[model samples]
Target: MSQTVYQQHAYRSNQVPPQKPRPEKTLAQRLLSAGQRMLPWSRPTQTVSTRTAQVSPSQWQKMKTIAPNQECFWNEQTLEGLTGNIWARVYLIFSGLGKFVILYFTPIFIVTLLLTSLVTTGRFGLSDWIEALWAYFLYAIFPASIIWGQFEMYNRSYWKPKLLRKLLDAQKKFELNRRTGMVTLYKRGGKVRYSYPFVEFDCILATTPSQQGLVNYSLLLAHRYSGSMHGVPLGVLVTPHETVAEYYRLWNMIQCYMDVTQPLPDILLLEEARPKDPTTAAYDQQTGRNPRYWRDMSDDAYAEAITQIEAKQSKMSETGPEIDIFAKAS
Candidate 1:
């Protein structure tokens, strides 16, 4: 019986092993990978124009109508056709009062002087009435003239120029976003290169109190870490006006990953905050990079970067520059 059992065991030696199961990806990993498509450094990718951006003849016309002098240097012709809404009441108050005094009061003043003079037997003659009338009329005219002047000043100096600047800035920003589209990841080495769009990240970062500060901080962050992160490639998009702030936006993007999924090490932002580089040096010695001035970056990066900035904003700290409400004040 033992010899028979040993022979059976030798014949059963060719059994096949079961195959291992493939690993499944988590939602967080999938999202992070998807978001990388927005990064320019990811890889070369073709983009379809969104057609959301427009610089038509009508836009120029509207720009001109609102504030010609303040309109874009390249699109002055459009502004020439546009007209600003003058505060009619302000004009009325000044010009109307001035005309009324000159036309109606002049005769009354003269008549009162002549009548008073004829009736006066005292040293105080009608000359006093004439002099007083002239003084009162001049005083009234001066104030009215001032009010009119202020109205013109507001329209010319403040309203039109400010509006135009904002429009130009916005147009430039949008044009950039349109050109860049969404870059998620960039892989470049031998033959293959491609970009991926991560997530449609929309965050509002209000750094320090001023837009300038926000711009500075954001840009600095981008400059510090727009390259590879944890061996994974990265790219950034931002507004032209907010390149500086975009850097900070990247820092916050990393922050978002950390808070929600995995926190990046401090080196991602601070990066060994070494001693200040030489003033004459074009790039940092240790980091081997130049400062990424915000204005130099593309608009999509600038906008996205700022959107990711994490501001220490509070009601008490909102007293710096007035937010441009038309542009949603940042």
Candidate 2:
């Protein structure tokens, strides 16, 4: 038997198959990718940490000590220019005359009308007369009031020096300090107009030797021509540190100084700083913590904290002072 020659195939050790070429990206796909990169919200979010700096008790005390009193005054030249315009002077004179007529002559005119009606109709019923008087009064009073307001604005001679003197006297009598004046601007018709000047007076008053730093009083006065034709007494602000009793006492003292016979002005309380626990304070003081870590805190904890804060506020309201300046005088 002939020996069969078996053919054996030899395999190479290092050989690679040819790979197919990759498809090119479409224009739309490239543009979409570029837009995604440019979009603000598409970017990865970064963690941020924020901590509010606590105001120290000493710093608060220093702030109270250094806080200056305010007194506002307009420039003399500006005041002259505003009050001295020929048209403004003419308007002021006419307004004054109109006010006099509305205040003094209107009642007489109404009485005359009532008498004439009675004489003509032989009727003395007050209903018709009163209604007629009311209608006439409304017609005359509205325009007269507006004109009077304009008169007050232009005739600064009565209010300007008087208010300044009052402020000066009050400061000297109360030993109060002045803060920076605040000027407001408004637009009227197509022109800019300056608001009436105003000032704030601040002073620390001690009710008793043992009760030092108990109350802080502030007086706000403004030259308001639109409401009252004279210096408008804004109000007295009483800020008590510990108790509402102190606030009442300080408010009464202010009333006595002003010789106010009417109901006392409203009292505004200062907001108290909330106290934090040691753990929370430490956590807040910590710097460079991942924002996500703080945000991941238990929802229950956040809710509880809010509830506690609200409860504290309610308690404060219950303990705070109640002042109603608008209450009818007894």
Alpha carbon lDDT at 318, candidate 1: 18
Question: In candidate 1, what are the lDDT values of residues 138-199, reduced to their tens digit?
Answer: 78656655655544454344543554333322221111111122222223212212222222
Ten-residue region with minimum lDDT total, candidate 2: 39-48
Best by lDDT: 2
Q: Tell me the deviation in Å of residue 227 in model 2.
A: 50
Structural similarity to truth (TM-score) of each candidate: 0.21, 0.22
Scored by TM-score, the top model is: 2
Q: How high a TM-score does candidate 1 get? A: 0.21
| Model 2 C-alpha lDDT versus the unseen true structure | 0.32
**Model 1: worst 10 consecutive residues (lDDT sum):** 74-83
> lDDT of each model, Cα atoms only?
0.32, 0.32
